[model samples]
Target: MLAHIGGRGFPPDEAAERAWATALWERTGGRPSGAPVARQIDAIRASGDRTAELRRITAPTLVVHGDRDLLVHPSGGRATAAAIPGARHVEIAGMGHHLAPGVLDRLVDLTTALARTHGARPATTPTPTPAPAPPTEEPA
Candidate 1:
């Protein structure tokens, strides 16, 4: 998924404020005196703390979290999966707070592995029941 970060989840508060102000200025065709998307920007800033909401995801998922991700935090990724019914979590050994170039490949590989293991089930067949035989003439 394409990320347009503006704080930790988006960018830092200052950067988000600045970026939003700049974008609003640009999009408004230079309306130099305006609210400057302040409310929208504040909402974006508040979205960084979404651990509880993420846990509610019920779809099958594979999470690859960087051990060094200060922004999102490693525990968040772990908590996300644990909250979901059957979600899987994968921690990358050398990943950082954010994905570097080609980081998607690692995620893809992780999800692929999860899908393979999750989709595969042991072969199961019911054992056949033998019919009862007639009683022998043992009594005299």
Candidate 2:
């Protein structure tokens, strides 16, 4: 579960994994308790479908998902983009549920571009030219 939820895209970082695992263990009662985790799972299950509420969101939205995410499946991101008007969905290849160290710069670039185009507050990261979309073939 930790492997799937944490960085599954890149090579394992034992130090980082240990740090997060320790922090999570401490948060969930130190001696190992699944109650908090169970409650979270229950809450998510109880939330029901929220398509109508998602449609009501008017802000410029970006839905970024990992193509390899096993924890939340890539389809969830697609559905979210479909529900929200004008929401742009981006699926990063080789990414899982967590952001691997290698993808950080690319994410920063993508987000910076989004913020700039939307006229949001200035971003500290210098925005690079956004990657061009892959060309699609039209049926003749």
**Against the true structure, what is each candidate's TM-score?**
0.45, 0.75
Candidate 1, after superposition: displacement of residue 64 in Å? 1.4
Expressed as tens digits, the lDDT of each residue in 1-140 for candidate 1 is: 12332113322345555687699889879867535458767887988867577767876788778765755778878987777767888877656564544465777778677767768554699898998998889878
The lDDT, on a scale of 0 to 1, for candidate 1 is: 0.66
- Model 1 regions lying over 4 Å from their true place: 1-41, 44-56, 117-140
Candidate with maximal TM-score: 2
lDDT of 2 by residue, 8-64 (tens): 565456788789999988876778877787999999999999999999999888898
User: Residue 52 lDDT in model 1?
Assistant: 74
Per-residue lDDT for 84 in model 1? 73
- Which 10 consecutive positions of candidate 1 have the poorest summed lDDT? 1-10
